[model samples]
Target: MSDTRTPLSRARGLGSAKEGVHHWWMQRVTAIALIPLVVWFAISLVMLSGADYAVARAWIGSPLVMVLLTLTIVVGLYHGQLGLQVVWEDYTDGALRVFMIVFTKFIAVLFGLGAVLAIMRIGFGG
Candidate 1:
C-alpha cells in the first residue's frame, strides 16, 4: 500500500488490462440514441403492416426514412456488440474469451451491413 505509484498508474487500475470506459460509454450512448428511434420504428412497422410489397417499398424509399433506418441499424448493432462484450468479459471463461469477443464483433458488423444493404435495396431498387 505504500508503493507511491504514479497518478497514471493508479488511474489506470487495469495497468495493461485495457481501458474499458470508452466501450462502456459508447454502449450507453448508443442505447440512449436508439430509444426514440425504436419508438418511431415500432409505429412505422405497425402502420405499414398489411401493405403490399410496393407500398412497403415506398415507405422505406424516402431519403429521410432510408437514412434514419441506416443510422438506427448501425448504432443498434454497435451498441449490441459493446453490451455483449461486457457480458462476455463478465461471464466467459479464460482461453475462449478473446475468441468470443472477436466472433461477436464479426457478427455485429455483419448484421449492421445486412440492415444497411436491405434499406438501400428498398430505397433504390424500387
Candidate 2:
C-alpha cells in the first residue's frame, strides 16, 4: 500500500505563504534601520533644544535631515503595517482578516503621511 500522504498535505493555509516570510523579514530589517535613525533624531532634538525656531527650521531643512526624515517615515510606516498585520491576523479571521489588514494599512499610510507633513511644516514654517 502507498503511504498516500503527499508532502503538500502537511502544509496549512492557502498555497505557499511565500510573501509571509518576506514581509516578516522586511519588517525586522526596517526596524533595525530605524534604531539608529531614531537615536539620531532624539539626539538632534536634544541638541536643538537651545535653538530658536528659525535655527531649528534650518537644521531640519538641511538635505541630510530631509533624507533621514524620509527614511524614518518609510521604515516606520512599513514596520507599523507589518506589526499591525500580525495583530490583525491573530485577532481576526475570515472576512474580517482582509478588512482589518487593509483598513489598518490604509490608516497607517494616512498617519505616516501626516507625520511627514508635520515634520515638513516644522522645517518650512507657514
Candidate 3:
C-alpha cells in the first residue's frame, strides 16, 4: 500500500510504538485467566460466609486454595495495572503521564505484595 499520510502528518511523529499490540494481548489474556478465578473466589466467599474463623482459616490454609488465591492476586493486579496504564496514557500527557504510569505501577506492585503476604500469612497460620 502507498503512504496516504500527508507530509505534515508524517512530520508530526505520531505513530505506533509497536508495543501497544503486546500490551493489548496481555490485557486480554489476563482478563480471561481471571474469569474462573473470580468466580471461584466469589463462590468460596459465599460458602465460607457463615463459617467460623477457624473453619475459614483452615480452608484458606489448604495448599490448593492458597495457590489459587496467589494466582488470582497476581493476575488480577497485573490486569488492573495494565488497564490503569491505558487510562493514564489516554487522559494525561508529558510529565503527568509519566508520573501517573509510574505511580500506578508502584501502587499495583505494593498492593499485590500486600495481598500475597496476607494470603501467605493466613495459609501458614502466621
Candidate 4:
C-alpha cells in the first residue's frame, strides 16, 4: 500500500482528526436543542416568579418539568464545554492550552453533575 497524502500534509501533520466534523455537528445540534429548552425554562421561571417556595418546588417536582430541566442542564453544560474548548484551542498554547481544556472539561462535568443532583433532590422531595 502507498500513501496518497500530499507532501506538505505529511510533513506538517496538520490534517484532520476525523472527529472535528462530529464535534462541530454536535455543537450545532446542542445549540439548536437549547433554543426551545431555554425558552421553556424562561417561561417556566416567569410563571413561577411570584409563586412561593412550595409552589416552585412543586413545579420542579413535576415529572415532565423535571425531565426538561435535567435535559436543559445537561445540554447547556455540554454546549458550553464545546464552545470553551474552541476558545481555549484558538487562544492558548502548549501547556496552558492543555491545562485550560482539561480544567474546563472537568468543571463542566462537575457542574453538570451538581445540577443533576440538585434537580433529583428537589424532584424526590429530599
State the weakest 10-residue window (summed lDDT) of model 3: 12-21
What's model 1's overall lDDT?
0.85
lDDT of 1 by residue, 49-96 (tens): 889978888878889999888888898889888888888999997878
The TM-score measured for candidate 4 stands at 0.80
Rank ordering of all candidates by lDDT, starting from the highest: 4, 3, 1, 2
| TM-score of each model, paired residue for residue | 0.81, 0.68, 0.76, 0.80
Q: Candidate 3: what lDDT? A: 0.90
lDDT head-to-head 1 vs 2, winner: 1
Candidate 4 accuracy as lDDT = 0.91
Q: Which candidate would rank higher by TM-score, 2 or 3?
A: 3
Q: Which lDDT values do the candidates have, in the order given?
A: 0.85, 0.81, 0.90, 0.91
Model 3: colliding residue pairs: none
**Number of clashing residue pairs in every model?**
0, 0, 0, 0
In candidate 1, stretches whose alpha carbon ends up further than 4 angstroms from where it belongs are 3-5, 8-15
Regions of model 2 farther than 4 Å from truth = 1-15, 45-56, 114-126
Return the number of clashes found in candidate 4. Answer: 0
RMSD of 4: 4.7
Q: What is the lDDT of residue 126 in candidate 1?
A: 33
